[model samples]
Target: MDDMKKLLEEIEKLKKEIEELKGEKEKKEFMESEKIIEVIDKIEEIVKKGFSVIEGAVIGSLEGIKRSLQEKENGR
Candidate 1:
């Protein structure tokens, strides 16, 4: 009977340890996902900035062309 009691206690302790390990695993996974989200956000910002720079360059080029045309007309 004493041996049976000891066995039961050991089993309960193991069960608790298993539960703790599961909790740790979940926390690790959540942290990894958050990191991935942060990386994606950074990439999105970089893409937006790249587009803005390209748009500015295009607008600047158009304005330069317009000025050149006006100068030629005035010269004539």
Candidate 2:
């Protein structure tokens, strides 16, 4: 569970990084965007595997997992 928590945090960080990249105006910086895309894919793979390990049920998208996390946070 702790590992999954870290993976969730990484996903959030990746989201912020992608947003930040979008705000950049330099064309040179845009070239680095592909690297971030690769990172996002890798993190997503890890998250999917983590979810499979943590939950035996049908774990769909990251959005669904996020909602589950949010529900847990709200004491559902």
Candidate 3:
């Protein structure tokens, strides 16, 4: 039964090694997910700011055109 005992020990060792690898893989996946979330948040912020700037520019352009037309009508 000595051969059977040795085989069992080898199997246990392999199981432990497999468990460690699984843990490492999970940790790596978690880190990658966190990085993706961070990048998405940054993109959202940039899009929001970009839209605000565009809206402001559009409003300013409209006001300038209105003023120009008013001045022309008044013969100024």
**What number of clashing residue pairs does each candidate have, in the order they appear?**
0, 0, 0
> Candidate 3's error at 53, in angstroms?
1.2
TM-score each candidate. 0.83, 0.36, 0.82
Candidate 2 off by > 4 Å? 1-27, 57-76
Candidate 1: the clashing residue pairs are: none
Taking the tens digit of each residue's C-alpha lDDT, what string does model 1 give over 1-76? 9999999999999999999999999999999999999999999999999999999999999999999999999999
What tens digits encode model 2's per-residue C-alpha lDDT throughout 1-76? 9999999999999999998877775565776897899999999999999888867555546668899899999995
Query: For all the candidates, what are their Cα RMSDs to the real structure?
Result: 1.5, 28.5, 1.8
All models: lDDT? 1.00, 0.85, 0.99
What ranges in model 1 sit over 4 Å off? none
Which candidate would rank higher by TM-score, 1 or 2? 1
> What's the lDDT of the predicted structure labeled candidate 2?
0.85
Model 3 deviation from native, Cα RMSD in Å: 1.8
